[model samples]
Target: MAVNNMAVQGKFITFEGSEGCGKSTQSKLLLEYLKAKGLDVQLIREPGGVAISEKIRSLLLDKANAVMNKECETLLYMAARAQLVEEVIIPRLTNGVILLCDRFLDSTLAYQGYGCGVPVEGIRSMGLFAAKGIQPDLTILLDLDVEEGLLRRGAERDRIELRSLDYHNRVRKGYLDMARKEPARMMVIDGSQAKDVIFTQMCARVEQLLS
Candidate 1:
């Protein structure tokens, strides 16, 4: 199976970016596009897609859990990921299902590792345990300015969203840095562009993998 790049196996494609980067929206569009093409595909949002993982997601995003430590937050994300990988990702990929995910390990690297002051190397090292050594074949990143991105989110932000602007800026930089390091695996798209334009670019990239 192709673990790191696009190949003929069950392709795991993840959409990543800051809070309002439109990763979720565009991922859904890609999901519908693939379905319309009669492809076997499904979409899974991180910290979700499974019963156990969803519970962890609740705790992770709850504003009441404001006292959650960076280390605690990091492990919780991993715990949720471990459940998700075991329950959703591994089996589907093994069955040759094209999985379109809203977020994955990259979010942890950006949010906790960079935004929360945890070490990037540590996040990568721990990610193996959570992801079970199965990584994305393609990672599509929706990049945009931190301020504009947060503005797009509007009110009713979650715990992570309520963090300081500096933290979010660090997270954004982390994503760009990761994308820069692995140009072949991660594709960067301008989130500020129109949805159709972004979807077109995303579709062209995905078609190459499907072909």
Candidate 2:
């Protein structure tokens, strides 16, 4: 599907936030909205877009792997991302698909760097290599309180989601910190708002980019 606007190049938009912050829902809504507008769009998630990445994602999220070390976890995430970028992301973007990602490099920075006590600089350095220099044109960060987000998850929690409140708080702070540093590229939105309200804000921002 070719886009009508020649001015609108392939845009990489990422959604970032802690668990249960509704990034997935918002990204999906954006994807549908763009498609309805006759835009060539694709929605994918981090650590599990392609076959290899999906395999890695299973390992990463399995509650059985509770004892996985922080360094190993970080490297595994990077490995999955590298595979995804080479196999799925680059080709889709080159073909002019408006790519909407549920999470991306920022997840590694927030999860491993802040939540797991890894060095932020180190994660960024490794992320650059993994992502092959592909940065999001716009990143929508859903800011939500740690406790509220956890409560929203209730019983079904993945390995990452089962982490302590302190860890989740660190992750949330890391996301906000990154947004502050890159205000132009990252839009911080309140996740506690109504779903329609959140989507409205997202659509408004994305329309600006498309226009």
Candidate 3:
């Protein structure tokens, strides 16, 4: 892919976590914080951020699609990602625009592969192709109790969120395993901590990268 050779002048940061772990809120806050520091930053989300990808996101999340198999789910995610990478992410990063993504390739690995029993090796290969060689500079994985996270989500749950507790637990485990294997790139934060505390910790890690 020609996009692979493009110089990434800005940082690419992504947030990962189980449902209702506050990654969306945290990513938003980080976006604001980065803007306050006068940096050129934008917040985009997986399965979204572009018109085509956003439609795919809706299809993937709609509870009506309950019968969708793991293979179809995984392919849809990759389709959206490929569009997002080509349409928005690559060009922005090439122009030195810092990007804060709510979720990325890791979500597929955890949700479809680990949680839904899809083959991990296959997902990794597809993810690499979908992302077109654009890897996150930093990944913040927010760790939280599955039950508590579900409680936070309340009655409003998407297709993925409506999965069994065991499934979500497996997803969390997958995330932690990945973090353990790549400690330098993935930072696991205690999502149970106070919002301000978590924010501060996130800032510290991000600033270290910026410096």
| lDDT leader | 3
> Which ranges of candidate 3 are over 4 A from the true structure?
1-3
- Per-residue lDDT over 1-211 for candidate 3, one digit per residue giving the tens place of the 0 to 100 score: 1356766788899999999899999999999999999999999998899999999999999999999998999999999999999999888988888899999999999999889989989998998898888899999999999999999989989999888999999999999999999999999999999999999999999999999
Candidates sorted on lDDT, descending: 3, 1, 2
Per-residue C-alpha lDDT of model 1 across residues 1-211, encoded as one tens digit per residue? 5434434358999999998989888988988888998989999999878999999999999999999999999999999999998888887997889999999999999999989889989999899877868888899999999889889889889999999999999999999999999999999999999999999998899889778
* Model 3 residue 88 distance off true place after TM-score fit, in angstroms: 0.7
Any idea what lDDT model 3 has? Answer: 0.93
| Candidate 2: Cα lDDT at 143 | 96
State which candidate, 1 or 3, has the greater TM-score: 3
Question: Please, what are the lDDT tens digits per residue for candidate 2 over residues 1-211?
Answer: 1222223247899999998899888988888888998999999998898999999999999999989999999999999999998888777887778999989999999999988889999999898788777888999999999888888889899999988899999999999999999999999999999999999998899999889
Model 2 clashes, total count:
0
The TM-score ranking, best first, is: 3, 1, 2
Error of 2 at 51 (Å): 0.8
Q: Which stretches of candidate 1 lie over 4 Å from their true place?
A: 2-8
